[model samples]
Target: MSRARAIGCDGGGSGARLALVWDGLRHEVCGGPANVTSDFAGAVAEVSGLLHRAAQLAGVSLEDLRGVPAHFALAGVVDERVATRVAAALPLEGVVEEDRRAAVRGALGERPGHVAGIGTGSYLARQGPDGFETIGGHGLVLGDEASGAWMGRALLKAVLAVEDGVEPATALTRQIAEEMGGVSGIVAFAAEAGPSDFAALAPRLLDAKTDSAARHIIVAGADYIARGLLALGWKEGGAICLIGGIGGKYADFLPTQMQKALVGAEGSALDGALALAMEQDG
Candidate 1:
């Protein structure tokens, strides 16, 4: 009899990744942006494409994928209704879970700990003896504090404040204005900017040199993360793994208390997806 096979998918605002496990070996593939809540069809298409690519790389035929269980941990999957929609759209047999759950399992495994995912979208998750609990993944408009999008939005706000005389013009503001082609350019960008667009500004915020405005933004971002951690019952000396594109960048800026709680992740989200698939297979 052939050994059972499974595929694990991790989808975020930036992109989607796949890991296929078969015959004791693993294969990986990448796909485009997949925020299910924002664009369900697009996200499903991206995930489907990556799954096929992963199957091929694993030397498994498309027909064989029918028997292989798959699990997807996706961003923007807030409720079962969305998960159901996503599941129905995909041509695979598996489960869909919130991205934060995958991050927690990937970062802490079965052990009790806390995770702060600070990518284009941010969320705080904690795993205890009871189970997993999450907070603050409400997207950019409502929440996602300390996330890349949040930082980017803050940068734009700072620039506008300087322009309107609400705050003194700083070097960072001037640089941003110059980069965005002055006030007009900033307005143009904001008109149609999405979470990813705002997240794109995070690198610039992180790279700004010796400016108080930039420093203030960084400090505020860190504080937001720290607050989320505390709200999730994180303690001063407990394990907290920072996960996501911008997760590590905030480490240095975190308050002394949070810094001490920070620890390395046990695995990536893909690993968590694989673990979930394996569990279902069992």
Candidate 2:
């Protein structure tokens, strides 16, 4: 008989990762974006390809996945309808959950706590005995207030402010204008830039650490996150783990009260995916 096996997939707007657990061992592989809500077919293909790669890395054949349970924690799968559509496209027996749940589980395990995931996107989630509750993560336009994408957008706006003389022309603004090919270039980029494209500019803000504009933007975003924690019922001295690309950077800027609650994540979203897959297997 084949040994017990399962796959855990974490799919975000920027990329997807697959973890294969079998015979007390685990293997991982990376793939392209898998936001099924945005591009169902493309996401499906990316996830499928990643699964195959993961299986191969584990010295298993694609056929070996027949009875294996797979759990997918994906972005853009907000409801049952979207989950159903994504499930129908895959050839596996598994469950699909929102990325927030996965991040919570990954960061906190079964412990009742809170997680603030701030990367290309941002979300605040709390998990307790009853279940999980999430706030923010409405995407760049609607929310994601403290996310990298948000910071990038803010930086772009500052560039515009400089051009229009609405704000002082700081070193940060001058650099952004030059890098983006001046005000006209920014206008063109904005016309077609996706969230990820804007998020890509976030590093520039970090690089411009000494600039007053950069400091202001970072602090503003941090304040939004701190406020989110309070709104989500984060109690004083409660455990809160920050996860994602920009999560750590925001830590220093968070209110001192909130900082006391910050703790290291026990694991990653991939681990959470695996935990969910194991539960399903039983």
Candidate 3:
């Protein structure tokens, strides 16, 4: 029998991951900074190269995988125009759905509920018997108001206030700047750093949880998440699953008021991509 093949790729704001299935088995490859719309051609090229290399490693040529069904869940892929642009760049035959859809499907297994992801970015999507809708994740600089990036930015602001002798804190202020390689370094890093970098500092900030300022940042971040959930108009009993690196990692730190909103999740966009591929193949 011919070896049935399929591939799924999800491009997050921070990084990208690909899962390929041949026959009954699957393989995954790590990629970098392939958020389809924000990075567009660059992201597509990165994923394309990643898939090509993965196939090669599996002793399959890129040409051999031509027309093999593929699925791509892309961050910053908001409208049809962006999807169409990505399609033209990648020229891969498969499905391209909203990144949140993939995240929801993967996390909730397509069950009706709200899945909130707080990674380098932040977003909440609600999938019901009728349809799916989302809020947040406009972008790292403008939107993603309560994401890891938001946390990091808030932390920096707090540190700056301390440095300026405006609002002193119990925790060390310079340490935050040092973590990002000093203030200048932070600016330089921002020029190239992906979503993960901003979120990476979140854990460090949490270490000072006893500091009222730090706690304020965390609570404030959770409030943003709550607003997104409120936007979905989810019923009191509706399931609210939390996904994403930050969401899973920092769930314990969310305000008590928002804690009741969480339902927890088991999978991610990666799993959702694989599941979609399987369904399409079948």
TM-score of each: 0.87, 0.88, 0.78
- Tell me which of candidates 1 and 3 scores higher on lDDT: 1
Model 2 lDDT-worst window of ten: 1-10
In candidate 3, the residue pairs with backbone N, CA or C atoms under 3 Å apart (3 or more residues apart, or in different chains) clash, namely none
CA displacement after TM-score superposition, residue 71 of candidate 1 (Å): 1.6
Off by over 4 Å in 2: 1-5, 52-67
Where does candidate 3 stray beyond 4 Å? 1-5, 53-68, 162-168, 172-200, 253-261, 280-282
Q: For candidate 1, lDDT tens digit of each residue in 9-127?
A: 99987789998888778899888889998898899999989888877888777678886777899988989999998998888878998777777888987778888888888888899
TM-score attained by model 2:
0.88
lDDT of 3 by residue, 1-282 (tens): 223577888887668899888766677898798877567778888889888877876778777777777778887677888887787777467777667887887888867888778777788888878787887887777888778888877787777676667986555466666666665766686678665676777887767777777888887877777667777876666677878766765567655545666676757788777677666746
Between candidates 1 and 2, which one is better according to TM-score? Answer: 2
lDDT of 2 by residue, 1-282 (tens): 223577889998778998998777889999888888888899989988988888788888888887787889988898999998888888776788777787788899878888889898899989887578998988899999989989999999999988999999899899789988998999999999878888999998987878999999999998888888888888888888989998988888888978888899999898888877876735
Return the candidate ranking by lDDT, descending: 2, 1, 3
Q: Candidate 1 has which clashing residue pairs, if any?
A: none
Cα deviation at 276, candidate 3, in Å, is 2.7
The C-alpha lDDT values of all candidates are 0.85, 0.86, 0.75
Best by TM-score: 2
